[model samples]
Target: MRPPSELTFRAVALGLLIGCLLCFTNLYFGLQTGWISMMSLQSSLLGYLISLLIPSVSPLTPQENVILQTTAVATGTMPLAAGFVGIIPALGLLDRAKDGMDPIHVLWWDGVWWCCAVAFFGVFLAAPLRKQVIIKEQLAFPSGTATAQLISVLHKIPPPAAARPGLRHRNGHTGSEDGYQAVRTVEAGGDIDEDAEDPGETDQKREEIVRAGWTTLGWSFAASGSMTLAAYFFPVIFAIPLLGDYLASKWLWTFSPSLSYVGQGIIMGFPTTVSMNLGMLVGWGVLSPLSKKAGWAPGDVGSMTDGARGWILWVALAVMCAESVVSLIPVVLELLRVLRANRDGHPEEDLETETEDRLVPMKWVLWGTGGSVVFGTIIVWYVFGSEGIKPWATVLGFGMGAVLSLLGVRALGETDLNPVSGLGKISQLVFAIVQPGNIVANIIAGGVAEAGAQQAGDLMQDLKTGHLLHASPRAQFHGQLIGSVLSIFVTTTAYSLYKRAYPIPGPNFPAPTAYVWLSLARLLRDGQLPAYSGTFMLAFGILGLSVSSLKTWAGLQGKWWAKWVPSGVAFAIGFLNTPAFSIARLMGGIVEFWWRKRTGGNRSANITLIVIASGFVLGEGIVSVVGLVLRTFGIGVASCWGCAEGVCPSC
Candidate 1:
């Protein structure tokens, strides 16, 4: 096996290219069938196949192989542009489109929205941080970990000839005894692959495998499927109806929204989650000995307390305030560090010596970022801004986007926050006061509704994987464009079908953000602003910022409540969604958590559980997608064709 240090840029580059191809293939399938779960599975299989190919021409160390493999997995899973933006437009749901909508193909307006809104923003924001987050901080984005692990496992397989030197080590050593001794003698030595029986021989074998082709493809398939399966299935099974029913049985509130059975089940899942998370904050931060004795019964706090709503609001605000204070301190320190380093430390000047060998040049990153900005701008101008946008305005948007992105990196810890969630929180607060018609509220509300926390979390994980695999900031930035494009279409198509199948009751569900833009034909249309709502959104953003801050502070302070907050949010969203969804999700999470905790995070057991979860999720998702498609065709009558039918029909 070639040592990790010996793995060349060529191998890594090849891995990335193949990974992109594999991911695109999966996306194509997903679009056709409406099943996104294949994303991980396909990517991993491609990565493994790529590893085998690399071995044929060059020797590789296990680490090199793993690193290469990770790049592909991470890049492939990114949410790219798909048909999501087109759904409302295609379905004739937009305010302006009175003509009604089509079912099968995406419209021009949909593409414009994605190109302008998501693609433009995602690329604009993701690019600048490529240097700060991926290079400077060297965060271990986890997507690459899967690749790293798979490569490690495969590299351990014995080579036919043990004595033969395989891929050369980056440290300039070989498989022979003399080289082994020489390698060991060096201080602060390079990594040796524990999985490989003989690094050199393995490298040769890996190179041969790469040349052989089949093994490389096989590995890619396995990893991609495994990753996707785990991600897809686990979330659904965990959110079921059991817990929500119990919660509803106990609590009697006059004003509670008449949620469906599924929605109620989701709430049940959340109570534990929310209660636990909120309880953590109350117990550790509010009631702990540091402040004063606080415990509302270990892990079982009463749901109803004296003035509970008031207490919750006050605690929430306090946590938010504390978080802001804590976050500002580090931000201030980091700013100081930047100023000092730029001024007195003269770090940039000195960087020439170290940067020459230590890191990728900033010039390339800057050039690439600038180029993407230009390309993205032109796309927006052609698609949405057919009449043309002011040069200054476009430049300003790009510039401000960069700044916001940097702030996002520093504050949010990721640059891809959906305006939907932030706005959703604001809508909740506003609807409490205005009691506006569903028409006005639903536009923003619907937008945020489709954009969920899970998607946000997954995006961050993809970013993490990119970081771990040493992908160039430029590559990741560009890759995100690809993913965004794919996602837009996929989401839009699914959503359009949903609206058609089950027409929303209130004032026609307002077109999603993209539809608004597409209707206006770009350049910050007046109606798109929703001035009253925009002001509210600003307040909501502040609220979110506060919430994020408190969560951080509680954790740092070693407060008891930190653990339960996740559960709490889950509960809230679950309660809103469906009782069934909540219960299923909670059970799944509980089981997974228990297994992980008990086994000390054993790899095999975790993988096994994830696989099962993936199966369940995929199965459900497939049925849903098929149902949507069938509904689109006006085939409402239930038949004995697929699983959608009551009984399995024998072919």
Candidate 2:
């Protein structure tokens, strides 16, 4: 049989379309909320819908769907480079840009090309690890597994009559009632039977499932779209006031009923959701109050300003940095073990078996990685050289990026979390020690490391989906390459235009991540630390180590408490985010729990719920894109509640 057509024209075109849409959405939201939208599952759902609507195109198999989503994942994630574009440029506008020395200027072409190179390099690094980590180690890449499940359900074919045994067809072909080919099974010493029971009933059931899925999707889309439009017009009416606004008028504790957050919570499951809520409670309900009582915080508990939160963030960052360093110890030891085994002529044992045909070609991986490295080196040289960075520094940055990219892949495989920011901070500290007072070197090296690590982690996730679905890795690689190239143009253009339209760190668009990056760089450059910075850093650093140690012990001992240890990333996010967002996510998880209990763990019902949740996420994202377009065209919705004046917070 001929191999399935995976990297088809229609698949590539649709993937690019979805990628462009998500790129725009992520760029807008990343600047607005300082968070990037997770795109794989959403893209898979949207891809299924598109394939369903376009009859002119052949229906996609599960593998083809995986290819399409792999492309979108690559394209959608490229907007992370907007941090470099928005923040690095904004630093030039600060008071420090007055000594006849111009800060780094990231031209559109340079930015786009650099981002493309970094993304491709990340994919290259991740490709080799697919079999090792995903297949061999059996890491539970939760998002990828969910995407695979979605694709499998969406494209399920009815079973043929021959599946029941004692039935056969002529010409070695067994066909289902739905006109799709089915696998053939033969009996010993028996002739084929021409007539068999019709499989139409199975087809009918499958059709009902498909129909139900689409119907649920339609309802969810309509509901979320209506809510989004209404929220835009009357934000206050849709806002759920969890805590009354009387305590601190500016810090409104209200949830926006974000369908996106709800969808994310349902997908992330109960453990992550509970941990996120716990983090919020500790950060806001517990720590903030204690700090206020001690006069360590300058504002009231309810109305804690960013300045007040800055102290807490300082502690969070220190904890994160320390955690990253500690986590690398095991990674280094593993690398050493592998090298030792290879050197001793005792080749490492294969832990998992896969068909040779299914594996990505080693030659392709080797050549591709080499080519990407050469191209990336050129791009980094051209981009960083313009900012007075030395050639040696650029090479060092690339080396660091390559190392961190592997670490990021390992972390994602183990935890489903990419500590890119923490990795970036490590790069900054390393470069700070090596090339002190060179802000250009610090930012460029840190950006390269973080960007590469992010891409590596993303590609690893995509590969996990492919592994589960038995998709050809080569085709997926092509899809990723295409998407990464397209994203270079789409994301770069979107970031450039958005930055030109809005002022960074302004009232309307507070590029919070950029602010953090610049603040860290300034501190490193000036060597002027905040008051009592050492005290806070040491305290938090010790606390973080202790937490990590306890979690490790629990895991080693196979204790149930390991599940409740709470992710360090969740703690950082809760510290940085407001209470309302966490509450909204917690509500979604609660609903899921209640639903499961009421339904007695019905599989079909749970699948239906997933479809609905996915639809809500897609609808919200689509509406947000529309809102961004309207704003761009000068037909923006005005804020109903004095959000611009800080009287009410935006979720």
For candidate 2, the TM-score is 0.81
Clashes of each: 104, 0
What TM-score against the true fold does each predicted structure earn? Answer: 0.51, 0.81
Output the lDDT of residue 389, model 1.
36
Ten-residue region with minimum lDDT total, candidate 1: 176-185
* Model 2, global lDDT: 0.62
Off by over 4 Å in 2: 1-4, 56-58, 81-110, 134-142, 157-207, 237-242, 246-254, 286-306, 347-367, 381-385, 507-509, 552-561, 636-645, 648-651
Cα lDDT of model 2 by residue, 304-356, tens digit: 13344554656656666665665555555666766687689975567544565
lDDT by residue for model 1 (1-651), tens: 222242457545654664454344333222221112213322333445545544355444443443444344334333222224222332234343321222223344544454334343434444435445444543332222333333333455322121112312111110000000001001111233444465456456655745544533334334434433332233222222233433322221111111111111221222233433343334323332221112322222112112222123223322223333344355446656766776785543221112233333467557655775576556545543422233333444445444433433443331112222222233323332332322322322222222222223233334444344333333433344444455444444444455565442111121122232132221122234321324433453465466655654554454656434442222122222212223334454455456556765444343343334433333333344454555467654432221211111111
Best-fitting candidate, measured by lDDT? Answer: 2
